[model samples]
Target: MSAALGLLAVIVLTAATGYFVAQEFAYVAADRAALEQAAARGDASARRAAKVIGRLSFMLSGAQLGITMTTLVVGFIAKPALAGLIQPLLDAAGIPEGATGAIALAAGFVLATLIQMLLGELFPKNLALARAESLARALASSTLVYLTVAGPLIRLFDRAATRLLRTVGVEPVEELHSGATLEELGDIIGKSQSSGHLPADLSGLLDRALSFGDLTADEVMVPRPQVSTLPSTAPAADLVALIRETGHSAYPVYDGEVDDVIGVAGVREVADDALDPATPVGRIARPALLVPGSQPLYGVIERMRESGEEFACVVDEYGGLAGILTFEDVAEELVGEIADETDAREDAPTTGPDGSWLVDAGMRIDEVVRLTGLDLPEGDAYDTLGGLVMAELRRLPCPGDRLTVALDGASGHGEPDGASGHAELEVVSVARRVAEKIRIRTAAAPAPADRPEISDPPCAAPRPEEASWTR
Candidate 1:
């Protein structure tokens, strides 16, 4: 070929190689849901992009075929042309004619390889990855055309690959999983937050939504000990006083044992001025919604919605009342604490000068990790820091109850916080038969002599009225 024609051919071949590389990466990285949304908005290029991603295996095969063919053609055109162009320069430099050809060939090979790798491979691949959706939409039409022209070769390659995969006990998929797994979604949310691509509040809400379904009745409920109950024989008028104190809309009415709840009564049902005050609450109570403690939170929610009940009594496997699950608990799992005018918000965890934190027992383990950077192991049996303390103690904790232990992890709390090594978890306050406050620090448990004076409630923090299970 003439020198000009050969150089032009090499440039065109290199362009083709870049095209295939870009297409391969763009198809993989493009978000299918975003493309679909654009297509729904009448974007023709997005529609083509979606089609390209849907047949990922076949399209990728075509990309491989195009890349291989272009690279081969570039080598054939450029190497000889490069040799021809360099040999004369060698002649002009007083090199022996016999040595010129081989020297030119080796130099041509190196130059050709560098040209292909940098321009044809690396640049396009990175550009495609950085703007995957944009490139996919811009190039999908031409990619579809190329795939049609190379259908037979691509299909043959795909089938052979599929058969080879099956022989090794693997199944070839046409496309990658379109939806992200919960764990992957969590990682995405975290990275987005760290990169400032997502708002912090939205990141937290999305994270909670992804994890909410993993909670069961047991994980999400108010424990039975905190339940405020009325004897079924008590006057209906007592609900008025209870509501005034606790501000709950509903209560579970039990015949005798809380485990034997007859029904649930609402304060709204007993506000009639002329209604007899002595009316038995059980008599006025409506049918109770019952759910097993082990039941998935989703199942509990479905039962409540289906039965039109605001509260469901969570029962342990042995038929004891585990606690009450409320719609507020359900909503708060996603939107966070739903405090009203009557509700007192729990205090934010307080960190001490010695790197200790006076943490509320009700805080989730995940939050504790974020706040203190503690690598506490999560357990299926419990979901809070208080629960971890209970597990370590293996029993109910009292004030000054000390559990000394070595915990492994960095404790800088990602700030100018104290070092992490030995951790002492001491029950600083107990309320309603559960640990209410814990003092966590990287030091030995205080000897009773060394124990600092502690108020029963720790910080004079007002009790959250919602702790009463007017569930």
Candidate 2:
């Protein structure tokens, strides 16, 4: 009976080893599953299961150590008892009596090692990993009970281990430092959305809102050329007429060119003002808010929110007016396009056939670049078509000066039109230059036959000055 009891103890110890080994690694999968389930339905069972797995992990760790120690102690203390039981088996195999004890001891060690490694460690670990969620739930209460019993011992060992680890200059693991990346979080959110755990519209909105962070100010800002304004010295009646005609709430009050602008005037301020046809436009204008062309859209948004100002004049580095950005322009960034009743349909920039674009005179140069794959330099100097033309001309350009310009189709992956495979624009007519505002006519061909292929020409080289601006 003693021998039988000793055999049973070995079997129990082997099983304990396997269970502990499995419980340690299985908890991670169980915890993840529980979190996913919780996100969907707030599953109490899953939560309990996750708690159980955690406790089981702790208990299993202790049990693994305890079982090995207990096996060693028992092998030493009960050797004679175990050897006597093995003696009969050895006799049946025709082994000598003297060799029995040695053989029995060797066999005992081998058996313990095998049971601990195979059953205790590998087998249970695999099971837990494979069916982590279900197994964790089933064993949670039992695992918790075991942990409760071994809590003091576990804490003592844990404290000792922690101290030893610190002595060896090893810090405890910081799970947060190993947390998910943005892509991983995005994936999680996407998966949640796909699984119907979140509302589709809300998820889509969040995704779009997050995506808006990627856009630069240049991509979203109102280009300088599209800005409409009134002269600072214009008659109050004329200013009111301009306001009435344009239907814009605010207008920049410039003295000569837009670059020499003084201030801005809101229609709302004029709405209540008494009819004073002779009042100078500059006198009624508010302080102008100016920003560099290169300012970030997000920073601009923040500044606008804090400043309480509705209008900002975009300027180049040379202190010339490039364009203007308004509160309405920034609003379009967050919520797509905004069209009103007063907006001219024919004057709007429209997509043309064969990968070309027909931009309106009032369209922002920045918007043109975004829509038609045009590459323009960024600085405080030029922010619009008019500003760009003025900067390139150096001197004021006249109507007759025909200049050859290259459109950067390579950057935007735009296909060339009929004349040539290269994407380039030829200035046909210098339409008008009212102060800083300059309008030029462009030829809608792929590229001139004389123009070199984009591939043959070094892309790194600066764009050639196709035509000089003439007076």
Candidate 3:
């Protein structure tokens, strides 16, 4: 009867050990955000779980206490009883008396350790991790009861631990949790994309947002020369016409020069019934928000929000208007281009005669490589094809400027015979003293001898198309 009682006590204590193990893991691994959301929607279980999680240190202490006590009780009750049960079996096997007792004790200890580790620790720990949220909610009530029963002991332990931590230069009040840093978040997004758990576009947007804080306003702004402006002294009628022609909602009104921009005038505000059409734009224009070119994009956005202005003029170190950034520009950096009715998009790269291509000056180097399948050098020296050309030549390219260099591989189909090639810059149009449109010509690749020859299409004559480009 005494041995039966000891076996029952061992079973109960082992079960308690497993329960505490599950409780500890479930609470720690559960998503706090998910718990909070459930609590907000009036889930009693989630509310209780969150309450326990709030004092995570104390809750962990309670779990440790329970696990330790239960393990100790099981060890004391089961070891002697199992050894006694095994001793008779060893003796029946004809083992000598002295060796039989030692062998029985060793065998029982090994068996007990294996059972305890498997059932009371590893199995419960894995289950909690796999179904952290559900297990956390299911165990919340029992965990609370355990805490109530051991409240005083847990509090005493917590106080001692906190005091010891404080002595080691640690803040006891700060929550102990692992947080994802920007780099780690980026890696997670990358992995999610690769695993098909996230869409590529969504992954890209998340990555952009993660790095948004590191960007500056100037990187996304329209350069000074590209910003359209109206004279502060211009008549309201002219302002209306400019607005219609530009299709821009706002324009900076300058005192005398672009650098002297004094205010911003919205076309809608000017067209209001309270305003006079004959009035000078400067009289009705709103004061312009001036921001440094070096200001972080996030801070600029906050400033825009607080000031209730969607546009700002970025000033350089010398107090000159460096560029202009609108709310849409900053937002685009985070979420990508927000197209509207005014957007004129080209669906494909223009093919030129003699197996060449006509690309815009603003075409990015990466886009060029992607479309043309040409491996061009990428560096900080230039971002666009036009910029690359200028940097190579050390001068602004004219309509006839030409340069030849070896490509990583031969240009496909329309390029000249050799792996090497030349790019002739045919300036189609100019804007803001730069080539806005350029026609690139390369030597045609020779057709295979076995394949029938295909005729090269005639070059499309360049039409005069030059205007301010907005992205």
Best candidate (score: TM-score): 1
Q: After TM-score superposition, what is the CA distance of residue 290 in candidate 1 from its true location, in Å?
A: 1.0
Residue 373 miss distance in model 2 (angstroms): 15
TM-score of each: 0.87, 0.51, 0.69
lDDT against the true structure, per candidate, is 0.80, 0.60, 0.75
TM-score, model 1 to reference: 0.87
Best first by lDDT, ranked: 1, 3, 2
Per-residue accuracy of model 3 over 1-471 as CA lDDT, tens digit each: 365676677777788899999999999999988998999999999999998888787788899999998888777777776777788888999999989878877887876787679888899999999999999999999899989999999888888888999999997764666578888997898788778899978977787788788777766687787788889888888888887887888888899888898999976667787767788999888999999988998889889999999999999888889889998887777776677776566444445455566677776664465445455555676667778666665655454445543455532212333323434445655555466676655534422222111243322343456422322
lDDT, candidate 2, residue 180? 71
lDDT of 1 at 367: 65
Better of 2 and 3 by TM-score: 3
Tens-digit lDDT track of model 2 for 52-146: 54344455556556666655654553455466577789989999888988998777666656665677667887898898777766666666777
Give the distance in Å from residue 356's predicted Cα in candidate 3 to where it truly belongs.
16
Lowest-scoring 10 consecutive residues by lDDT in candidate 3? 445-454
Model 1 CA lDDT for position 426 = 77
Q: Name the best candidate (by lDDT).
A: 1
